[model samples]
Target: MSKEESFQNSVIRPVIKMLHDLLAVHFKHYMATKKLEFSQLSEKEKTNFIESSFNKDMAFRSEIRGLVIGHFSTEEFLLYATMQRGINKRINTILKERISSNRQNFVE
Candidate 1:
């Protein structure tokens, strides 16, 4: 891998994983409190649910963005952003797979 990619893998990736883990815990609590069963939501409802959850935490997102910006050089930050986009796409794919699996379980 290139140096930028190596840097991202070693450094930025851990931070991303930690943030995702933290969010996962928060989301688990939210789901429990709200009686949220992802399997039951229609596709539109699921989209709305995810959007609303993020919308409720703009400050958190901004804080994370600022943290990332502060930690990286401008060029590195650009690479980090690109890597984050890939990570996000992977996350979305995982979410879809999980929801689909849950729906299948419910159906069965």
Candidate 2:
């Protein structure tokens, strides 16, 4: 696929889905762990909790809002892509170490 097409399908869509899933999972775990009483809070208090808990940086503020909030904007998805790239780089480094450690298996 072309760059733009791949960005739309692979980068944008997947990241949005992943972000949404992470948020939902976190909220559910928090509720179950804390036995939250959402009904006890006032309107402003509820909003405050939701925002403080869910409102992430530019990396997150947009994707969650896309599906949940009506007002959504581009919040530099590249920032997260950059972070993921760093994680993958770390994995590659570990893989490199393992291969080097077992290098004698390959040398004749």
Candidate 3:
């Protein structure tokens, strides 16, 4: 493996996998309360794509598994993972803008 690959295997990969797993659970729970799919990702169809692929080598997507995930119904366990992703994405976006504004002020 390249040095970067080795490093990821030793560090980054596991952390990402854990994050994916946690997000999977959160998404599962979030959808349960909502009753139906979020509607944003209806084209993707599979609710647990993010959760199920955490363990897969690709770290994200593969067609057969995705098709299978599409068949999997939502439950308390499934929605929590995706919900966590959504929350994280929002927080990160806010934080990024905050950091950028702070940097601009410091430059002035």
Candidate 4:
């Protein structure tokens, strides 16, 4: 597979999976802080909210990105730094999918 795909599978996916619970909690908190009634939204709307939140909220995006990136080793980080933009896009996409698929985890 490609270098990006390798790094994603080897590093990013595991880190995100390891932190899945934390991510869910953060998502719930994000909805609360934004005064969004996450439970009230339909499945489609919930998916759109997840997409729009990442697209529109830089602070929230960065915070989530930081959580995943912070777990990378120095070597993995160097690799990521070399292709920051592309890797970041991959990270966000994976994160969005993870969150969307695990939507049940966020329900109170």
Candidate 5:
């Protein structure tokens, strides 16, 4: 398949799905281990938690970027970066909403 086609069907779609699953799993584990809903976290704790999670996720994405650059052409690499940014933006929105809802759960 062409790079664009392969990227859409194989890379972007699967990666986005995987990222969502990863986020869900991580959040569940985090809450379980902390024994507190998001709202229960202090402001500093919340900052730390978000930073830690963001770093882990960014590291994962960096590894994927490295592998893609090694296997794909330069043009495809650019495309991949652009698509990744867009995908991540959407995921960020979902994460914010998830966190907000988690906080609300504790409020009620």
Candidate 6:
């Protein structure tokens, strides 16, 4: 597969999976801070909220990015440094997909 795909599968996905509980906790805090009633939203609205949060909230996006990047090895980080933009997009996309798929986990 491609370099990006390889890095994503080996590094990004594992990081995301490993930090799943932390991500959920952060999402709950984000909802509380924003005064959003996450549990009240329908499935479709929940998905939309996840998409909109990443699109509109730079701080939340950055926090999520840091959580993933902080787990990378020295060599993996060096490779990521060479293609930050593309890797960032991949990271965000994967994060969005994971959060969207696991919306129930975010609710208390």
Q: Once model 6 is optimally superposed onto the true structure by TM-score, how far is the C-alpha of residue 90 displaced, in angstroms?
A: 0.8
Relative to the true structure, how large is the alpha-carbon lDDT of every model? 0.53, 0.41, 0.37, 0.92, 0.53, 0.91
Number of the candidate with higher lDDT, 5 or 6 = 6
Best by lDDT: 4
For model 1, residues 1-108, the per-residue Cα lDDT tens digits are 765557656666555445554445545555565688866779778667656654565553454344434556677667667767654434344433433334333222
lDDT (tens digit, per residue) of candidate 5 on 1-108: 665556656654454444544445555665666575766778777666655554566654354334334455576557777766654444444454454445433233
Question: Which portions of model 5 show Cα errors greater than 4 Å?
Answer: 1-14, 18-22, 42-45, 54-108
Q: What are the models' TM-scores? A: 0.38, 0.32, 0.26, 0.95, 0.32, 0.95
* Better lDDT candidate (1, 4): 4
Q: Give the total clashing residue pairs for model 3.
A: 17
- lDDT, residue 49, model 4: 95
| Total backbone collisions, model 1 | 0
Q: Rank the candidates by TM-score, best first.
A: 4, 6, 1, 2, 5, 3
Name the candidate, 4 or 6, with the larger lDDT value: 4
What's the C-alpha lDDT at position 17 in model 3?
39
Q: Kindly provide the TM-score of model 1 when superposed on the true structure, using C-alpha atoms.
A: 0.38
Residue 44's lDDT within candidate 5 is 72
Poorest lDDT segment (10 consecutive residues) of candidate 5: 60-69
lDDT of 5 at 58: 68
Which scores higher on TM-score, 1 or 3? 1
The residue-by-residue lDDT of candidate 6 on 58-87, one tens digit each, is 999999899999999999999999989999
Could you give the C-alpha RMSD of every candidate to the true structure, in order shown? 7.4, 18.5, 17.4, 0.9, 8.1, 0.9
Any residue pairs clashing in model 5, and if so which?
none
Instruction: List clashing residue pairs in candidate 1.
Output: none
Off by over 4 Å in 4: none
